[model samples]
Target: MIAKFLRDPFGLEDAFPPLKKWQLWLAALELEPPIFKTDVLSTVNDMAGMSGKDKETVRIMIEDAQEYSREDSRIDLLAAAMGIPPNQMDDLWKWAAQIEPI
Candidate 1:
């Protein structure tokens, strides 16, 4: 069921083999406000145990989020994949707001 949802938009053929999760997440952060919040939150939650390069990647993403504005469809797709609700997405943004950009 979940797999169907994740693949519905981007397709599940592995044709693009999702760029490292962090990269994808970072891309999402650059998206429009709602999507940015949702993706960043979902990514951080899904990759909770992130380490090494992943951690560094997320830090960079946080920094990027502090200074960009665009729409990222990937984030919307990811939020759907993670089953994050719209309202909660705002909380996610608030969490992101607390992070000091590097």
Candidate 2:
């Protein structure tokens, strides 16, 4: 799922409309923090983009989700939410992590 999203972020929107734009951001942030941070920086440089409120809302959500958690716990939660089997989560995350930022 993370691989699919990375390959075509907006393309899969029709399949998961229930996931808000911010939720997508959270997923990217958790799955690949470095790339996600770079993407956010790019977004910031765009003339027409996320407002302060929009950025703050997603930032808060990401912070709340990660509060008092270790990396393993965070990965476990994300994997569970995506219904990925525990044994396969690491490989899946590794694959997603390798994807070049768009």
Candidate 3:
């Protein structure tokens, strides 16, 4: 499934493609601390630099977003908070792309 995105007929792939919200959540559970989907939000809000508004924004995104854009700065922030290296984002993207939508 991920191959379709990474290896398209068009030579160019989006440097930072948006991933489905469910895919992102699934990858989170599969990858690190292995927390429940519910905990993912709290974890991000708990990050050191997050403020009240930022926390609210994250909550809203997680609750309502259809896709999580790799281009969004918040994605990087979330990855960093989760101890994922910037260069290793592809791991998350690949893992995410494999998830079957619930």
Candidate 4:
């Protein structure tokens, strides 16, 4: 489920093949405002417990996802894939807001 959800918009599974549980949790976590409060950097830093090189790759993936989310149809696609309510996608954006540059 999560694999397909992330495939197109984020290509996450590809970026981290044999995707671990934490990666999926990170996806879900990115949608939750209160939990992931800061931005993609925090998400990468907090959840990506990987080497510096791997972390950079994950960061690039996240940056790409954020850029992709700008299109409404893409947002709907992602929201549906992630089981997020269409109406609440704005809230998801709130969580994804980049507080500062990495």
Model 3, poorest ten-residue lDDT window? 9-18
TM-scores for every candidate against the unseen true structure: 0.28, 0.32, 0.70, 0.34
Scored by Cα lDDT, where does model 1 land? Answer: 0.46
Better of 1 and 2 by TM-score: 2
Worst 10 residues of 4 by lDDT: 13-22
Clashing pairs in 3: none
TM-score of 1: 0.28
lDDT of 2 by residue, 4-102 (tens): 789888874333122233444444556533236444434433525557775555445444543322243534544444445666554544444344435
Which has the better TM-score: candidate 1, or candidate 4?
A: 4
**lDDT per residue (tens digit) for residues 15-101 in model 3:** 545788878877777765674656667687777777899888977887799988887887786776566787777667865776785
For 11-89, candidate 4 gives per-residue lDDT tens digits of 5322312223233335457543523323435645654446787656655544454344334353454454355686565
Ranking by TM-score: 3, 4, 2, 1
Among all windows of 10 consecutive residues in model 1, the one with the lowest summed lDDT is 12-21
The superposed Cα distance between candidate 4 and the true structure at residue 85, in angstroms, equals 0.8
lDDT (Cα, tens digit) per residue for candidate 1, span 1-102: 687777685653322222333444444465554345454545665665656576456545544553421134434434554456654543444444444434
The runs of at least 3 residues in candidate 2 whose Cα sits more than 4 Å from the true structure, single-residue gaps closed, are 1-70
